[model samples]
Target: MKENLKRLFEYRELLFNLTRKEVKVKYKNSFLGFIWSLVTPLMMLVVFYVAFGVIFKLRAMDMKYYAFYLMAGILPWNFLSQTLTQGVASVVMNSDLVKKVYFPREVLPLSYLGSASFHFLLQEAMLIVFLLAFRVPLTPWIFMLPVLMLLEAVFIAGLTLLLSTLNVFFRDVQHFTEILLMAWFWMTPIVYPISQIRDNLPAWAAKLYMLNPMTHIVLMWQRITYNSPVNGPASYSMSPAGVIGTVACSLGLLIVGYVTFTRLEGRFAEFI
Candidate 1:
């Protein structure tokens, strides 16, 4: 395990090239180019806002009950969701290269994540712009963003490792992933705020939501942005304990995914 980790560091160039390739391919032959990333999320936000915010008039008590609420949650969710969907096909997409060359198989998945997250970063910048446009106050607590982002990277990479490897064997994994992702989006506290659910809700019910993990990530985001000037009193900011848990969970999933991938990778070339 230590050797594999060391090897990853040793071949950092390979990582860079692969990440660059993914990013280039992402915008390849596109008319609007990278604008697609920004457009997609923004368009979705408008649709959702009109449906849930206007028609239904959901009173999002904690999250300002507005478009910004969905923006914060959706931007991160879009990154995580899109990366996994596209990354599941990473190994197969490079099937020719995989057969001919020998590189850290894990690096392939990591590259997809790195490239996708680049777009995610752009979306985040736009999110910041929205916050500013609305006069949301900024605070030192916003510095916590990088830490949360790293946590997000860790979690997404882990999931990709597991999904991409399995995807090679079972083409149906792609279909299954689609269904799972749809369910996951709903499970996450993206479309709505967690606080609106009432503090006195049954413990089991809360557990059901928390089990999603993205729940914690979303709440942390709301806390960070809301603390500024957007939606004050939206949350209790992540404490040391919360930070530890986020990192631990991210690392734990990453390790598990690596083990599963290495174990299953031997079969990828054959089964795939």
Candidate 2:
């Protein structure tokens, strides 16, 4: 593992270059280019706000700046979704390079993650701009954005490495990931508040829901970006135990994923 870490470090430049390529290639021929990144979350915000905030009346429940709340969760969720969707197929998509190259195989998924992270940051900035435009108060907790992003990234990188490695062997893993993410999105408290789960579900069921790692991560995003005092105590759902568990889960997954990726990477060429 130490040797793998040293070797991956040695190829850091390669990772950066590949990440750059992924970002550029993403919008290579598009007329809107990077604007689409901002546009996508904006569109989601509008649709969800109309559906939940307007139609469902979630905002009537004292959820101030509900659009901001939606964006807070949606942006990070999109980051994870895009990373998995693209990263799963990354190794197979670059079979020629994989067969010819001697560099770290992990770079492929990490590069896609880098590209998604770029868009995630841009969307988050756009969200902040919207907040300022609407005269919403900013809090000291907003400074913790980078820390939250890093935690989410660690969780994503682990999943990407593990899934991408397996994807090379089983093409179905890529397709399965898409379906899984679709279900996973609704399972996390993105479109709705976490309070709904606690209030609506039985205690045991709510406890099971909290077991989702993304649940804590998304709630933390909502807590940092959306949970103003005016939004009430219900909006503030993150607990110390949840934070500790999330950090432990993220680190554990990264280690397990890295070990799995490295062990199977030797057989990747054969499978691909």
Candidate 3:
């Protein structure tokens, strides 16, 4: 791992260039340019707020500003989904670079992550603006956001490495990833609360549902935004044991994903 880190550092310039390229190409030839990053999330937030808040009244019924509440969760979900969608194809998409250049293939996904992260932060700025506009009080729990975001990034990075490497051999992995993410987006409480699952699902099934690391991650985000701002006591539906289990699960996936990537990467050039 030390050697790999050292090599990546040696190629840091390439990493930056790739990340810049990814960010630029994303908005290139578009009239709106980077503004779309903020607009996309805002558009979705409006649609969701209208659909769930106005039409169905499905959000935290107690909260007055459902748009802000929905934006908070949606921004993070956008980051994760974007990272995975691009990361899954990072290797195959950049096959020319992989073949011509001699750098760590892992950097492709990392660079994509860097670009997505840039966009994530931009979207978050809009979320903060919404908070201020809605007069949502900022609480000390907002400090915990960095921790949750870090864990979520680590989780995505591991998956990126694992999926990018696998897609090189089995091209179907890329297509399958889209379906998986679609299902995952709904599975995670992006638009709705986790309580709905507990109320509707059997005890065993609810327990299984909470087993998803994203469940805790999303709940933590909702807790920080919804509960903390109102000075409502911090609460997570997942037990302490469940939280620990999810953290352990994320760490394990990181380790296993890295190991798997390194093992499979030897043949990436041949397959690509």
Candidate with top TM-score is 2
TM-score of each: 0.90, 0.96, 0.92
lDDT of 3 by residue, 1-272 (tens): 77777887998998899889999999899999999988898888888888898889764556566676677678888888899999989889988977787788888898988899889877766666667787788656777877877777888888888888889988998999999988888888777766578678999988788777887777777766554333233445435875687678878877777777777776787788
With candidate 1 superimposed using the best TM-score fit, by how many Å does residue 146's alpha carbon deviate from the native? 1.0
| Count of clashes, each model | 1, 0, 0
- Model 2: which residue pairs collide? none
Cα lDDT of model 2 by residue, 92-192, tens digit? 99999999878889999999999899999888888888888988877668899999999999999999999998898889999999999999999999988
What local lDDT score does residue 236 receive in model 3, on the 0 to 100 scale? 52
Model 1 steric clash pairs: 137-229
> Which model scores highest in lDDT?
2
User: Please, what is the whole-model Cα lDDT of each candidate in the order they appear?
Assistant: 0.78, 0.88, 0.79
Error of 3 at 1 (Å): 3.2
